[model samples]
Target: MDNEGRESGHLMLITPERVFYAGLLGRPHQRCSGAFHVYVAIKGGLRLAAEGAVEGYSELAVVPPNLRHTIASDYRSVICVLIEPETVCVGALDLLAKRLAGAERQFFVGRIHAACEQLQHEPRDGDIFSSAFDIMCFGDALPRRILDARVVKAIAQIGRFSGDPVTAASCAAEAGLSSSRFLHLFKQETGISFRSFRAWKRARHLLHFANQDLNLAHLAQHIGYPDSTHFSHSIRRFYGLKPRAIFSGSRDLAIYRSGRAAAGDSAWTQEAG
Candidate 1:
């Protein structure tokens, strides 16, 4: 590890379609996330087991979206990359994963490790975006998936989480389509059901507050969960860690939100308390 990385401790760079995290691995439990996940070991190697896949240990690993998986490393800290499924072509990501498994595996591992070090020393107020994330790790941006105009508008609405709840019916109304049609089109466009997309978005928003000192109930309300019970259950289901565990592990981490953060909020960045 570089001196900057060691000094910085833990860092999370979050954007609407990409996240680069260098932090605690936490307990290796089954986590089904909504992104194309890539794990790069810092020192030794990572052991990963995904649904319908053989268990393996390597310095690099990739898991597709919505797959239940667990990963562990010899060390407590590791680098993780998350590429949101809706933003890019899944086939492209799959191909990229395969290429990484080939000769390029060591190349990307070196790139990511170097990027982690560079990011740690970057200006706190610097703006980061998904394109930048790709360039940082892969030398170029990945191909983007274009959606229908109406579907794009609906996605924008869902991405912008507010106190008001987001629903397929409401989104359908806004898109001038029947609920059934809207749902069908959404699945066609994103390769994911509307319910699952919205749920994952809500759960993903938790990363924004991972380092905050706040009440879980209030946080749940802020995230638009019906109640703390539902919030806890949903968080555990998606992340394989309790909400408290996430926050606790991130106590000393720095969270940098890009100009277009996952929540579709205005750009800003903050250090963890």
Candidate 2:
């Protein structure tokens, strides 16, 4: 979902994890600007359309910014929390976020979602925010013991490289599987395809740099975008706002409910890159 048409809300989580309820529906109008990060859980089933192809995400889909997407499901879904990029250190949490993204579409096997709900119901923002800040400031990068080493290996390969050579066929070859087999099992274990995962990773990479002192074109290359226009198109899908606005801490559009920022009206996003 793009953030453009949706309202952006803030929450402070104090635990190691938290969960919140979320719903997705179809509307007559196109939507822009969604979560900087997105995890989809559908009841009964999940359907998504990207580019021109439509598919099902049985467990959940880890989606980034705009790629022209939507969902259709009868089951109830609880969208998990997105750790404020500005408030915490990313290290292992990035790994954790990726790991959860791969969970079963039911995706109901972790403290992550539970923690998200806790944060949502918690009364005070101070305690939760402070606790989460500590974890972000000190947590280690994702450990190998959490999931199948093969999965980690696959993610590492993609995260470290890009371009046409970095296709699904290549990644499957590295894992000693055919492309078809790779997509099937990969989704079974990770809940998303290699392609969508890579796109999500790329979008996150760009967001980390959106606040930097780099031009759009150079920043595009940094995140593996072939050109600035394409880069703009990607972020705009999810945020529905240009890079310039996010970089400037565009408060005119800052998502505060009723002119209130529980965190003291402060919207400074720290350098996560």
Candidate 3:
């Protein structure tokens, strides 16, 4: 919310026939669980932001994680094409950055648009990700990015006990691996540490309690924060603003939202058009 006008729980849907997209790279109230590759093409746009706005939002850029996050859509033109969360691993993303090197605005779109179109036409059932992977295997064609079978088995063990007090040691044990090995596999597949990733996943559950009507302290406790101060600090340190800043008065943000709503699919600008 520092300026790109996005907040937690803002989703860009990607259906079988469509790639649901959001121009605003909503900063979060908490850390992010995972990272994925995105092939962006912009006619003219704002710099991506982690906090505070960026100037003269640019044409096209590839975003990598562990950097300050910023996504701004300028009044002139904005276009972004995003890959879904589970598609490609962080290593795959890093590999793409090393191999591709062109600054021209339009160079990226044709490649990505063609990939998306290829996925859109594939058969609709049972493991569409695999079909899509085969269609868009422009990178190293690694299975690590496709979420290993063992990793898939571990996902539920980590996710199921959310309401209970949990620690990485316990989570790692549940996955039947030594703590160090568990962490290495998790980071390789997900692009984040096990601790931060769990917290990132936890924030989604915390969202329901974040409504304006709720007391901030109460909301913090409800989301597993035993101390309200700790929660507030975490919110600020991670997303660059306290929780209260979101939904506070910001006319430009409001205008941006309304226009996004009205445009619907048309909200996807030329680069992604």
Count clashes in each candidate, considering only residues at least 3 apart in sequence or on different chains. 0, 27, 10
- Tell me each candidate's RMSD, in Å, in order: 6.2, 13.3, 11.0
Tens digits of lDDT, candidate 2, 72-159: 4555333433432222232444544466555432333334444444433433333333344323322322221133444556665665
lDDT of candidate 3 vs native?
0.44
Give the alpha carbon lDDT tens digit for every residue of 1-273 in model 3: 222323321222233222323233344233321333343433444454443434324444555543455444443223334333434444555555554434433444555545534433432233234323423534224333345544544554554434766666765676677889877877776656767765644443433333235676767776676687777676655444566763342222311111111123222222200
Instruction: Give the higher-TM-score candidate: 2 or 3.
Output: 3
Best by lDDT: 1
Candidate 2 lDDT? 0.44
In terms of TM-score, which candidate is strongest? Answer: 1
Q: Which whole-number lDDT from 0 to 100 does residue 177 have in model 1?
A: 87
Ranking by TM-score: 1, 3, 2
Deviation of model 2 at 263, angstroms: 29
Compared with the true structure, all predictions reach lDDT values of 0.84, 0.44, 0.44
Give TM-scores for every candidate, taking all chains together and pairing residue i with residue i: 0.91, 0.43, 0.52
Could you tell me which 10 consecutive residues in candidate 1 have the lowest summed lDDT?
Answer: 264-273
